[model samples]
Target chain A: MKARVHITLKNGVLDPQGRAIANALHSLGFDKVGDVRQGKFIEIDLKESDKAKAKSEVDQMCAKLLANTVIENYSVDLVE
Target chain B: MKSAIVVFPGSNREKDAEAALTEITGTPPVMVWHRDTELPKVDLVLVPGGFSYGDYLRCGAIAAHSPILREVKARADQGMAVLGICNGFQIITEAGLLPGVLQQNAGLKFVCRNVNLRVETSQSLFTSRYEKGQVLSIPVAHHEGNYYADEKTLDELESRDQVAFRYCAPDGSLDPSHNPNGSQRAIAGVFNRTKNVLGLMPHPENAIRELLGSTDGRGLFKAMAEALAA
Candidate 1:
């Protein structure tokens, strides 16, 4: 089984990368950058076949190692 | 007072912290490995800088889950004075011991240079020696020391005067030119909600000795030592 994780900065935390991207877009004449916040996407291949277990384990990974919960939030997706 | 320094696999600044502590306090700090579940009995705990776990996921993502951090958090909750420097700051944030987060530098480049940080408040154990709002030059080297918080949180920090140090230019006033990471409001250091713990991007241990180019950093550690003694 495979698991995909998407992590993003929690709401109200400053996103310098997102701001830079917006500034760059404006500089390139794309003035209307409604919003942008950079985030991380991770894909992991595990040996377990149980989707629920995979989710639990992967969520634990997010809480323990994968995502920085103080400033970031994470969501997990299971892919068979 | 006994002290411990957390040594994550990729942390390079642990020794610097040890040296600083030994130089001032005359006692060497115990090196606490990440895998270990225990920290030495100590009144103070330090999380030093460097690429902990090679900063693989984020500045401090991996090290925050180490077994020892569980104990560190416990001790911190019990009122032990905890200080996180540089990547150490990242780890503290990752562990939810501090506020907001350290984000990538606004320029998207790793910044390594001497920066002047004005002491915003000297009431805490970490900055008791410096006069309030006095600017002192210290060295900062990091990729993700850009401090960020929302408007409401920022206002709270301001209202409570929780901001500890801020980026400053030589003239002793806040300046954007000296903002190495484009941090929100040019924040360099901050204390926890209780003001007992501190996390900062710059390395004060690196500046304590005059031979290292500035003795400004010595007063900070010295102040903490006196506070510890008292």
Candidate 2:
């Protein structure tokens, strides 16, 4: 089984790196971009065969280490 | 007074912290490695600044899970004093010993310079030597020193008088211009609810000697040493 984790800064938290990316996109003439927020995408391979168990384990990882709950939020998806 | 300095693999400021603490207390501090699960009995645990674990996946996020921190956390809960500077501040916050998180500077640039900080409260063991509202010149060197916290947590921190220091103008005004990293309410340092754990972005160890252009940071070490002796 495999899992993917998406970590993103909370809505109200300041995202300076995302702002820089947005500015770069604007400078490149991609004016269609209104507001942009950047986030982290992580994929992990698990030896566990149970999809349910894999998701629960990845969820724990997100809460414990993958995401800093104070400033960022994380979501987990298990791929069968 | 006895002290131990925690040294992560990528930490480079342990020597500076050891030098500062030794100069102030007349005793050398033990350098504890990240892999060790036990810490020698000491009055204080100093987490010095540096790019711990190369600041991967967020600053201090990797090093926060190091084995030694478990001991540090236990001792902190037992009322032992723990002072975290620069990257150390990020680690303690990630370890849940302190509230809030440090984000990148608003300008997305690595800011390095001398900034003024107002001693917010002298009630904690970390800032007892400085008078409330006294401004001290300290140097902040980092890219992610901008502090962030939710409104409710911010209000709680303020009302409980847990804020240790705030970035301010030389004359002590907290205008936006004086905030170098865009920290919430210009907070430069914070104390845990118990007041024994302190996390601050500025490099107080770098400002301990007069030859370093300012001795303003010495007051913090003095306050800790005195508190331990008493």
Listed for each candidate, the true contacts retained, as a fraction, are: 0.79, 0.86
Query: What is the C-alpha lDDT profile of model 2 across B1-230, one tens digit per residue?
Result: 89999999889889999999999978899999999999999999999899998999989999999999989999999999999999999999999999999999998889999999999999988888999999999999999999999999999999999999999989999899999989999999999998999999998888987787899999999999999973
Q: Which ten contiguous residues of candidate 2 chain B have the minimum total lDDT? A: B221-230
Model number with the top DockQ:
2
With a 3 Å backbone cut-off (N, CA, C), the pairs that clash in candidate 1 are none
- Tens-digit per-residue lDDT, B1-230, candidate 1: 67889999889999999999999877788988889997888889999999998988888877877889889999899899899999999998888888778888978899888999989998888898899978898999998989987778878887887899999888778889989998889999888878878999999999988788887888878877887773
Go through the candidates in order and give each one's C-alpha lDDT: 0.87, 0.92
In angstroms, how far off is A43's CA in candidate 1? 1.8
Q: Report the error of model 2 at residue B188, Å.
A: 0.5
Quote the chain B TM-score of every prediction: 0.97, 0.98
Error of 1 at B180 (Å): 0.7
